[model samples]
Target: GSITHILIFASGASKVPLAGFQGTPTITFLEPGLGQSLPTANTCSVSLNLPMCSTFNDFSEGMALAIACAKTFGIA
Candidate 1:
């Protein structure tokens, strides 16, 4: 038998004074698309610490990024 699990972490602030995002490995690779809205306010900092057991390649990473973004920010 085999068991697997994936963990995704996302955090952000609302109404921040200044600054955008620090950019993580997944974020750097995904490169947030235009028109994408984050959960936090315009002036806020959001973060996601996603974890995947397998399929951690570009494709999976992209999918994970999208899922995380949408789930956190309610994107589509």
Candidate 2:
């Protein structure tokens, strides 16, 4: 099976920001409404590498983003 999304949470700072990273495939399409429904087909895969998120509040924020993404993709 192919990967649909990749969300990475790192404790240290990344040399390159997530928006500037060029290693991952482009996510050409995203589900509308932010957190509404599932897509009928796999449009593209997305990768998000968030760094320096070691604190409790940072972790919470990361989890929140994860949950929001999951809900947006209808996976949660």
Candidate 3:
């Protein structure tokens, strides 16, 4: 089957604001470069924290948005 979409999301769990963002962003899928096939429907665990006005709810929403963007061009 053909590829669907590509996604890249980062999480900052450190109590520090900017510092956390700079550090390792509890990645879900690593090395999912261009021309790669999309991943299956599943949830990825991460220990990163959400920024202001950004909670688990917001993160989930953002994830959806990213997926949509990827589908637009079939990044995978």
Go through the candidates in order and give the clash count of each.
Answer: 0, 0, 3
Better of 1 and 3 by TM-score: 3
**Candidate 1 stretches greater than 4 Å from native:** 1-44, 57-65, 68-76
lDDT of 3 by residue, 1-76 (tens): 1122221222212133543334343533424234323322222332322222225565455555645553433234
lDDT of 1: 0.35
CA RMSD per model (angstroms): 14.1, 12.0, 14.6
Models sorted by TM-score, best on top: 3, 2, 1
TM-score of candidate 2 relative to the true fold: 0.27
Better of 2 and 3 by lDDT: 2
Worst 10 residues of 3 by lDDT: 1-10
Q: Candidate 2: where are CA atoms >4 Å away?
A: 1-53, 74-76
- Please write out the lDDT profile of model 2 over residues 1-76, one tens digit for every residue: 1122232321112244656544453333333435423222222333332333336585456545554455345335
lDDT computed for candidate 3: 0.35
RMSD, model 2, all Cα superposed? Answer: 12.0
Best by lDDT: 2
Per-prediction TM-score, please? 0.23, 0.27, 0.29
